[model samples]
Target: MKLFVYDHCPFCVRARIPFGLKDIPLDLGFQLNDDEETPIRMIGAKMLPILQDDGKYMGESLDIVHYLDALDGLPVFGGAPDPALVEWLEKWNDVINDLVIPRTPDPVYPEFATPEAIAYFTRKKTATFGDFDGLKARTPELIASLELGLEALVPLLPDAEGASINDILLFPVLRSLSVMDGIRYPAAVDAYRHRMAERSGVPLVSALRASC
Candidate 1:
């Protein structure tokens, strides 16, 4: 029940869904940053969204989500998911790597993008895509691709009120779009994002919070 995660990681966001919907309090407090990597290293993967349950550790986000979903006794894919969605999740990382991450701001803002986190992202991303500036310059194409990608997913999202694995999966992508400028998903996808947020029990997180 002890979950290690960075608030902004899309993977972590996906992993948080079961807890959010079931309203299970995390056994661990807000342990962030390097603190997360320590125990995860013991598991030999050194990854985020690592769940420590009864001395066992799981690394991958999907694995963590699936494990939690099973514990909650929810069907992981019973809602007649879109065929496009199935393909999309299979290629989700590729989409993030090739299109979204490059266009995203270095710090990602208001979602725990500390200096160290930003540094790590830059280093890793640069290694994957080469020349961060060049990647950023392709914002137009990348953003368009992102929109199309999500549009392809809008139909597959579950109608369950705020609590399906699909809702968890889609939330982070919508969040990433909110961070980018000059990017707008078509009306259907935009509406779908809002409804999915409502149903998943995790509302969209905004960068600027009002004092009130």
Candidate 2:
């Protein structure tokens, strides 16, 4: 099976969680580039974390997460996830995503991004946000909201003995947020991130950070 992903994307991380838990040997389907036309022409959408199983195509990170869970017979919210918790997570994801795209300045792109991806990102983000400096200016208030979002999410975090969707879902988002200078998470949330990173069947996040 092949999973197309850009490691920086939290949604892509979501897809990886279930694949890791299922012990599936996944091949990289694509990386960030205009160089790859196959995903757009074939999958019909430009999105990270597209899963191609045999000749089948799957997109949407949460759906893919659910698909992986179903494939492995592991229920994320136990036998049936609490509907309210699901709604809450979706809301929190929106909160984290707001800050992630806007405030992540370009100075650090070379640390993990390819030149092509960085160029594409700079153009795309400039168009989307319109005023990068203003966005950067608002980051502190945004970060405060982000922390509150995590605080709300803490109750929904799983007590599962292994890699749970709860932790996997938030890991990359928090990781991305942490990249911004002067960002400091509350001690409790940082502790949670550590515990999630240590889960069984989960890949070492250091691999992604190994000078990507």
Candidate 3:
């Protein structure tokens, strides 16, 4: 199996973390900012986190995670996520992708601090859920919603043990949120954030920070 990704993309980071945690042997191909053709050729879209297994290509982080989870005999939704949970997870993914990731600027790159960059991001952010301030304000609410979902998920984890999809899906968003100032979360969510920070896959986020 081979994975093609760039280090800065949160989607790619999240997709690769599960593979590493599962100890899956995979050839990694990284595309730098100037590189373009490989992604288009491999997946018919210029997207990072493209997975190729036995000549079969898959794109989109969530889809790749689901596929790999199936291959490893792990539950993609943590032992059968209910419909409501599934819906929330999907929405949660979108919220992070649209609102959080864009608002939380990369710490290492001040070039992205330009007015033009902010304008571009403002456009992308507005396309999702309207004003940036409103969307940013709702992050706590989103985290709370995730905590409610996690509360439902805690008992369903394999052996009532460690992490689940809830952790995988929410951790990166929380980490990204931490990069920003004045973002507050509930106590339970903060505790979970602490736990996720200790995971083996947590180093993968540093890979992203370096890219920035």
lDDT of each: 0.62, 0.62, 0.59
lDDT of 2: 0.62
Which residue pairs show collisions in model 3?
none
- What does the lDDT read for residue 15 in candidate 3? 78
For model 2, residues 1-212, the per-residue Cα lDDT tens digits are 78887655667767776665566676865465444576686577777778888799888887877777777665652355556666876776655555666644343433235666666765777787655666667777877877676676666655544555555555656566654555566666766665655542333344334545
Model 3: residues >4 Å from true position, as ranges? 6-10, 26-36, 72-79, 82-101, 104-163, 203-212
Candidate 1 lDDT (Cα, whole model)? 0.62
* Residue-pair clashes per candidate: 3, 0, 0
Candidate 1, residues 1-212: lDDT per residue as tens digits? 78776555677767776676666666533333434457456577556777888888887887877777777576453354456666787766565665556544343343234666556666766887788777777777776776677676666765645455566666666765554556576677777766665544445544322211
RMSD of 1: 3.8
Q: Rank the candidates by TM-score, best first.
A: 1, 2, 3
Tens-digit lDDT string for candidate 3 (1-212): 88886544667757775675566776777654434577788878767789989888889987887787777686544454345645655656654554455554343433244556446545664786577677767777766665565565444322112546655565555565555444345556656655565552444334446555
> Where does the lowest 10-residue lDDT sum fall in candidate 2?
103-112
Clashes of 2: 0
Candidate 3's TM-score reads: 0.58
